[model samples]
Target chain A: MNKLSRVLGVVRNQLATYVPRINATTQAAVAPTADPKVPAPAKDKHEGLMEFFDVKENWTTNEVRVGRSWRKEELRIKSNQDLHKLWYVLLKERNMLLTMQHEMNEKWEPFQSPERIDKVHESMVNLEEVVRERNRAYYLLETGETGERPGRVETNKVGMHYFFKASEHVVPPEHNNHWFKKFGCNRREVAKFRLYYNEKIWLGRLKEKNRNTRHVMKLYKRFPDLDEEALQAEYPDVNLERVKRWNGAQGHFMPRNL
Target chain B: MSTRWYPIYQRGNPQLRVFLPNFWMKLVRPEHKQPENIVRFITPTQMSDHDIKQYLEKIYKVEVASVKSKIKEGLIKRQRFRGYIIKEPDYREAMITLPPGQTFKFPDISTEKEKRDDDEIKKFQDAASQSFDKFKEMNKDRPGVPGWFSV
Candidate 1:
């Protein structure tokens, strides 16, 4: 009983300090109340087609101020139900912006805050990413495999590897002659191409290696006092000792190492 | 599942559900006069008649009795200076019929715009007159001299 009371005392102290700190933070963040003379914005009363426009008062205004997009961290804390409702809100907002933009384009009037579209798009993207994360976690807990569609790297007709996302097909792969004819290339031609392609890549790499070796030798010949350890670190593939022994490494100045 | 993905519809499989639909529909003024009950919309090219009906009915809570959509091919015009053909993006327009009692009309937004522009012009004129008065006062000391000479 005594130990329980002691633990409660610590929690009580934490609550007392933490609650006041949170209150202070909120108070500091909130703006001061508007003057009594200034009228508060009227609630949105528009419906249907009218919803596609900004409020009547804002029609002629040169600038319209809006808040920033919802951050991913802020959205992740919301419940799935709240996120679902927010999705509809964002969708409607996007549609309204698009409609307003279209009308403005027709009339040659400047649309206020064009970034509003981007903000809504960003919020929607973040919401989707958060939902995807939750879905992945839930699926991982329930099923071993990710709920996402299965895909694999496969060679295309152009002989390039591409990720092929598997989808449900009425006809199985073996039975689908159209799929085989479209994606399959001539075996002999593909083999020859692959061999030549690999040789080209290998030659390019060999050239680069030789270039680095020659560059390192040149550097040593010009700057005898150059930091050999630093040069070795910079080009790990080059044999520094072998380069130092090369005749081209000799310079007019006596070697600094000697 | 996302709205972007669609699995092949098998006869016995349960109906697919779109949890996050990202399609956008914009209400546009009709190029030609439309009936009071008819509303025009520009939707994503991929939207079908059924999709348009469901989108409005479900998302906007607007009753859509019917939906007819047609793709307007973008205009291709050759640039006079650059000698290149420029094509506008193709768009699909949908005409939706509302319930019997409902009617919609596009509001005129430019009526108040002219009044606002007049106010702005008046303000600019006032500033210009005030600056001209200041210039006159500055030149009063040296009569018949050009304004640029004093500056």
Candidate 2:
């Protein structure tokens, strides 16, 4: 057992040496050191509680200028661990901004540059999307599945289809009596309701089609030399030739054919 | 749990880890006077006492002795202009107690702001008086002439 443990340790050390140090390079690239010629700004002491508020100078300022949010492409190049660290940094910043805004609201003062909240939120959303993309790609490559929460299109009692997100359950469908009883639907009633619902939808579509045809006819009547190809392209669903045959489509002066 | 979804916990299963926890907690001033060691926070309603404790201890690196939390119901009132009922969003309030000897005092920022405002007002008044004096000096040559007539 001792010999086996020693060999395993040797293997671990070898593997560690073989792995490239990606984190160090990424960190250096992310935050470059300030130039030696230019004096660095004074660093604030870590006042644990006061971290919730903005700097004292900005407390009274009317506007605080800040750069735009982190774009998706910029975040896409970052490693997972770097992204994780960034997420916390952004989260802390968001909390601080929120705290400042809340205090300002209470004191009847305008919160300077409220768009900063939106910027942080946008960065967070982009970061999450990038992480999800990576996770999806990894899952697809390894498991041959999307790895997202499984969901299915299910018809409700009202006969309307909705996406039902599947949740983990210890009990199987056959054993879950309570769920089956609660979700049971009346087939006959649903069928009758569905007929009316479908007809209503169809009627709405028909009205929209008629409105488009009438609109096209008005256009033809207004512009005698209207570009027929452009009009056809604009309203692909509407039959322009049939609408042109209508009397309302004729111009006041003279027919173009004559 | 706030932003990212986690798998359900089952017996004998591996522990669920949250890679991206989106829970946010904002430090708020206590409405009533509280002990120096206690800090107030406004958090999402979904956050529990344990979550608040873990959040402060793990993320903020603050030593927490105990945590107490309560959900404040939103106020429902009639809109003055529209005469419609509107409800404010409900939020969870957390009171975190630090270990002995650790104390935090809320900073007073309003006094500094008031001083700056006073300076601003004085500057504006001085500028206004100077502009008025110049206008009067220009109009002294021609009496009873409108200011816009010269321009």
Candidate 3:
């Protein structure tokens, strides 16, 4: 049964490799709503459309007071298409608020309720997560790997040791001179940076050794029956026998080693 | 559109088209006033002058004459007893020149803002002063007892 399951898993993974990612077609299909007659999109897509576009409620009133942001869980069930459309709506709303805010600032008037933008941002993030959740679910069903960008640790020029996620470069790594100059970590970098880097590494090691030596001496004074081999094993660089004879390591009575 | 991770496109590969770019640009009140067309913006710092131009022209359908941008560092202050300095987030401010015809007016946020802040502060003071009055009332008959331990 185990062997059969293993073979089935391999077959699924192999098949996933062959299937094309939904990139081009997905982009084309989800293009702008050309059909002006197509009755307003479902509620999620048009959630903020009616109210936010214009100050329809109180056109004369300069400020539009609003409530709090939408919670994440409330939006988690929404579809991808709705989330996509909603993103544009939010983008437009933000721009409108900005325009309103700019005019207020110029007139030396106080900009009302700046937190409205924050609430909209909060809603957009929740909406994005909802879409991502569905994408993850679909990807898990179709492919073993997450359909999102694959990330891994990579060394860069600074040699400070940072994690860099490899990304899709338009040119291949070798041919891409700009990428090589900026991002790529070559043998020359490893050689140049490694010398000081190794020195820094050894300095850290020395500090650890000294700290362990002091700790072991303190341990010897309190617990006379402390296992010497295990102590040495725990800190390979620390000498257990010498730590026992230190003045601070002496207990109230005669020395345990003597 | 000009984020670090996305590819730097050349002429060919079906062009990385943005049906609706999700970048948000807010027109903030500039600390100092200049021309009427030069509108200030609070935007992501990575956005370039070109990005802002495309953003207004493509998304808002507004015509832009020109754009210039700069990053402003927020205030840095040390908190009491925290032993660490906290700096407010850095923000990008853009000055975009709109076409000759268009004029924008920013709405006043502080009409209700002042009232809300004043009321909140007043409530806090009332709560504090009321608690003090209650303490005095409870202690009126117990003059001999010490203030700290009597309660």
Candidate 4:
């Protein structure tokens, strides 16, 4: 209790010292308005709906210089409340930039610094990623789950597999007759399609392997003195000895001593 | 984020709250003349009239009397050579009415820019004319000669 009272006393003394400073700052702000010789502040007192547009000075300029987007590392250090506020600030900036671009397009004028939109978009993406990372960490610590939307790889009627994102529903899958009727695909035709699709995929892989092997042989033929280790590293899947033995791998010059 | 996937709402569940709503609202010029107090905005299709009202009131601090919105169909055009049809994405437009005494005017942002461009064009034209005059003076003695024949 003694320590608590002492801490409270220190906070009270600090507040007493800070109160006059805050008052002085407010007084300084008001002093400018009282002086007739001094020019009014550059920023308007209230922007209202005009906040949708860029500053008046920028309207006529062909370039509006701006810094790069917020990095994920920078956003990670900020607290959740700061991130929340920054999200709105970025949102408002994106909206303003879009508005300016749209209006400029309508007026047949060039929108300056179009990359600003991309920068803001990149910042928003990084910010969201950081938020998601924190959320995932929190959920994992609390519930052993990522707390992200659930999805699964499911084969469609066309035998094409896709990630199906699951959403909340009033009824379970067994009770949802309509969903089952739409998504259920056990027909013989689908089975045949899947078979053909698998064959095509396998053929594609085979063709790609053959192409790589041929390319390696051509490289060997062109540059017999090429570093074997580099070639092997480039095409790890190709059998270097088998490719070296192929006729295509031979050059017009005499074979070098092994 | 505005494009983040959300779970479907079911009755008797806790109210869903968007702590960091990222929906964007662009103030657009009205297609037709509107009342002084009416402002037009293009927002995401997912936003309803109530959402538009609350967005302006809460985020922009604008007092909205009412809001009416409609989904505008995008234009469909065919490729010039290939003739493949392309349809632009549809957008939602909201017409917000401010309080009776309040009004907003969409300022003309291009006038100053147009004037500056005109000055630049004039300068370019003057420079081009002066250069042509100089070239003519240089080639006065050799009429009908090609410009490439010059040293």
Best of the candidates, DockQ: 4
Model 2, position B27, has a per-residue lDDT of 88
lDDT of 1 by residue, A117-231 (tens): 8888888998898998888788888997667777999887757789998888899978999998876679889888988998999999999999999999899888877887898
Task: Put down candidate 4 lDDT per residue, B45-107, tens digits, no spaces.
Answer: 989988888888877677888999999988899999999999988899999888877778887
User: Which candidate leads in TM-score?
Assistant: 2
Query: Model 2 — TM-score against the truth?
Result: 0.75
Candidate 3 or 1, higher lDDT: 1
Interface RMSD of each: 3.8, 4.0, 9.4, 3.7
> Which consecutive 10 residues in model 3 chain B have the weakest lDDT in total?
B1-10
Off by over 4 Å in 4: A1-47, A207-258, B1-5, B78-86, B118-151
Q: What is the DockQ of candidate 2?
A: 0.29
**What DockQ do you compute for every candidate structure?**
0.29, 0.29, 0.17, 0.32
The numbered model that scores best in lDDT is: 4
TM-scores for chain A, candidates in order? Answer: 0.73, 0.69, 0.52, 0.66
What tens digits encode model 3's per-residue C-alpha lDDT throughout B100-151? 7555443344454455657878989999999989888888887767779773
Give the docking tier of candidate 1: acceptable
Models sorted by lDDT, best on top: 4, 2, 1, 3
* Model 2 alpha-carbon drift over 4 Å, by segment: A1-46, A210-258, B1-3, B128-151
Stretches of candidate 3 exceeding 4 Å from the true structure: A1-72, A88-122, A136-147, A155-162, A168-196, A222-248, A254-258, B1-5, B19-22, B30-38, B48-50, B53-93, B97-101, B108-151
Candidate 4 lDDT score at position A48: 55
List model 2 lDDT by residue over A37-83, tens digit each. 87643222224556577777776777877767778887787788667
